[model samples]
Target: MTNAEANSGKKAVIFNVQRYSTEDGPGVRTTVFFKGCPLSCLWCSNPESQQAKPQMMYFSKTCVQCYACVKACPNGANKIKDDGSVWVDRSVCTNCGVCVKVCLADARSMSGKKMTVDEVFDIIQKDSLYYINSGGGVTLGGGECTTEPEFVGELLDRCYDRAIHTCIDTCGYTPWSVLEKILPKVELVLFDIKHMDTEKHKELTGVGNELILENAVKIKQMGTRMIIRLPLIPGYNDDENNIKVMGWFMESWGMDRIDILPYHRLGENKYDALGMNYSLGDLPNLAKDSISRAVKILGSYGLEVHVM
Candidate 1:
């Protein structure tokens, strides 16, 4: 939706509106989660936010097998064929969001919502006092805010006009032009650094880190406040060499603050709900000691580190 429309109460695609979140960004903040992401991080916590389009999600465990979705589907998307099993005909389904409303067990749900900018602003403004008190304001998180550059820029610009402290939690996978357009409007950026190894980066997130790394340097040069977030995945980029390389890179780039996010199984259920397999199922969370070790390694380079 256009900014005018968004401001005028026209709908824009958003997945979730999280409040009182501490980990996303500074403060007792409200996080506006936009739908759609460019990169597919295997350890993505919000699998529901990946797709740009609205889609139906199923919680098999919560389902009573009452065939409510089957009966409620207008396009016969939920049905049993000759195989004697229910199937969701994704192609025919318009995601009209009907079956989700009728589901009694909360097994059927829709991921994205179309909200206006004015609507979103109202939500964010509600916690303005809390933000002022807690050093937190509004945080824009998503599949990738840069993927919807126009919308993101306008949102930030509006927030800037209101003197709201805005932070963008991004994967840095967008074009430089897009980043350039939105970066000026934001106060702080929570840039995610997934992997240091280019090949391993591609293997995990479907793209290399070249552009991401490059953009980070450019962003640093532009003097935007930034904090680097590293997701420590076991058997992946958790090696000492990898951590050292990442530490060196951050040091060279003059990034002082780093947040090491330990991998967790919290999102495992989301993958299943989205009808996707969890790739990191067998992988265990990095031990607290390991996180401490990584912190020490980065600290040795004189970097301020926070392990979450």
Candidate 2:
């Protein structure tokens, strides 16, 4: 069932509720992936979560092109443009969700569902036993958890009241006020740092890094336990200079640990499922030695580094 149906009496937008996650935080956890994000990172792992609304996605590979969706759409909203590329006129479509229901090959799909605070709490509460055993509880990940600050803040407050260990896996791209609202309830913050260079960061992620960096420092200052996660993308931010800059920043912030997420092509397939281009497909995964080099650089600054 859609999140909306599941939370008919409440209000929030959740795209996916993933359980038994070990990598997100301190222990085994449940990750609630909120539905919207502000940045357009080229290597984003979850492109479907980018848009805030419930929208259709087409997997061309799985599509038989039988025109099932074309036939089912009542508003003539689905059509093949003059260039022979299938397109959905989002403005005309009511999101009645007719096309997705009739797709036999599972090519057409929808993302995002409206949910309520209580409905979300129910899901997180189910895993309370697991949390108690593993020292883990709930982690709010996104599309940028801060995108819907009020919902996140309320949910976080509830989790905190329940004594649940909460971690916010964020891009640090949100306003400080929003961070301030949620920081008190968060036990740990998994903040992502993509690149040190503002221009390079903008080119890669389609947003400036100034606010993100500022927010990171603010989060640290707030005394919330923080871990910086660096996605070591090859030819993007894997150079010695970038690593050194990152090390210097971590050292200055008095932050001890950082996660070196060696870049992988694992999410390339997801892009196809969403009918989006995988620009980094041709780029090979970051080499083990390259990751080691990065780790050593950070270690030189007396910072603990985990290569994940």
State the lDDT of candidate 2 residue by residue for 163-228, as single tens digits. Answer: 889999999898887889888888999999999999999999998899998988888888999999
Residue 281 displacement in candidate 1 (angstroms): 1.4
Candidate 1 residue 41 C-alpha distance from true site, Å: 1.0
Model 2 residue 159 lDDT score: 82
- Tens digits of per-residue lDDT for model 1, 68-181: 789888898787768554667667888888988988889878899887777788788888889889999889998776777766766776777777899999998878888888
Clashing pairs in 1: 27-136
Give lDDT per model, in order: 0.85, 0.85
What stretches of model 2 exceed 4 Å from their correct place? Answer: 1-10, 77-96
TM-score of each: 0.92, 0.90
Number of the top TM-score candidate: 1
RMSD of each: 2.8, 4.1
